[model samples]
Target: MTLFVDMDEVIADTYGAHIKRVNERYNMNLTKEACRGGEVWQQLPDHREAIWRHYFEPGFFRELDPIAGSQEVLRELSEKYEVYIASAAMQFPDSLKEKHEWLDEYFPFIHWSKRILCGDKHILRGDVLIDDRSHNLEHFVGRSLIFTSPHNVNTTAFERVNSWEEVCSKLL
Candidate 1:
């Protein structure tokens, strides 16, 4: 089976990175639990722009750490399925390169040939799609697995997997 996996919240800890930067820059205490069921900008309405700005930063994607168990699980998955790292990276030009490098460092098993950097998810064609945003999964013709992120906790429109272990159990 061909599996398309999202990078930001599914494999990389972009949500945590955003929260950390926002908390540091705004001098506020914002935890993942507090921002559950919503985006970081939504939780910090006052610092919405500031939080959004983090995504456009030079090293934002470069400095992000991998989500727990993502490397191992993705490696295991890659052994069994044709896995592709599909990310919506056109919005931020810098992120395109940074995300590619990040994936190379963390998920080296997924070759450059399997990496797809696009602006929209609608063009993706695969047997299974694992992403955090419902919008990406909404129009997907394949089975959609919503990888839980703090921002999408309230979303229940698709099959959900809170952790990589859950993903392994469901797909592996």
Candidate 2:
């Protein structure tokens, strides 16, 4: 099976990183639970532009912590499927290189050739796609699993997996 996995909120803890920075900068107590069904910036209207700018900053993607259990679960998944890392890297041009480096550091076994750092995911043809964005899953012809993120908490368009363990239970 060809399994395509998204890098950001799915395997990388980008949401948590944003929330952490926002909390530290503004001295507010913001939890993932508090931001459910909305983007972190949406929760902080005044600082929304500042929060969105985090993506444009250098090394932002490279410095993000990987979601817990992703390494182990992806390693196991790779053995059973033609696992490819599919990231929407073009939204932020700097992210392409940073994301490449991040993947090399955290997921070297996946290989450079298997990574698809692209503009649009609709071009991909695969058996299964695991992503945090519902729009990406919307165009997928195969099985689409929405990896839960705070912004997508209320999205019921696709099957959702809250953790790598849930992913393992379904796809592993």
Candidate 3:
């Protein structure tokens, strides 16, 4: 089986840093407790790019701390399936490179043969797509898991999970 995984919210807590910056800049009482599964983006979809650019522009990929148990789950999954990364990050090539480098450094067991960066998941078909994005779930026909995010709501054909451990349970 070949598993295609999303990068940002699936493996890394992409909004953790963003939330901190938002609080600092706005002086609002934005607690991490306020981070629901789909409200963040709903609140400010228009500012998504700008927020990412400001908070995640430099060394963001390199600074990506793996979600707890993510590395272990990927390592275990790699033993059985060909795990490939297909992030939605089509614009920032440098950030994409950083993601690859970081993955290689942390999960050295993952072979280069299975790694890939694609703008569209439909173009790179996989047996399973573990992504946080709802639109990408539409393309995956077989098994699919939607990693829960602060911005993913109206999605079907994808089981939602809050953590990598949950994903491991579903996939394994």
* Top lDDT model: 2
Q: Candidate 3, residues 10-129: lDDT per residue as tens digits?
A: 877776667766667656566545756454434457766767675347787778777778899998998888888777776777777787888788767866776777777777766888
Candidate 3: regions farther than 4 A off: 37-49, 153-157
After TM-score superposition, the amount by which residue 18's alpha carbon in candidate 3 deviates from its true location, in angstroms, is: 1.5
Model 3 lDDT-worst window of ten? 35-44
Local error of candidate 2 at 149, Å? 0.8
lDDT of 1 at 93: 91
Residues 1-172 of candidate 1 have per-residue lDDT tens digits of 9999999999999999988887787788989999888888887688777778888989999999999999999999999999999999998998999998988888889999999999789788889999998999999999999999988888879999999999999988
Query: Model 2: per-residue lDDT, tens digit, 1-172?
Result: 9999999999899999899889899998999999999999988898878999999988889899999899999999999999999998888988998999999899989988899988688899999999999889999889999998989988888999999999999986
Off by over 4 Å in 1: none
Cα RMSD of all models vs. native, in order, equals 0.9, 0.8, 2.6
| Model 1, C-alpha of 171: deviation from truth (Å) | 1.2
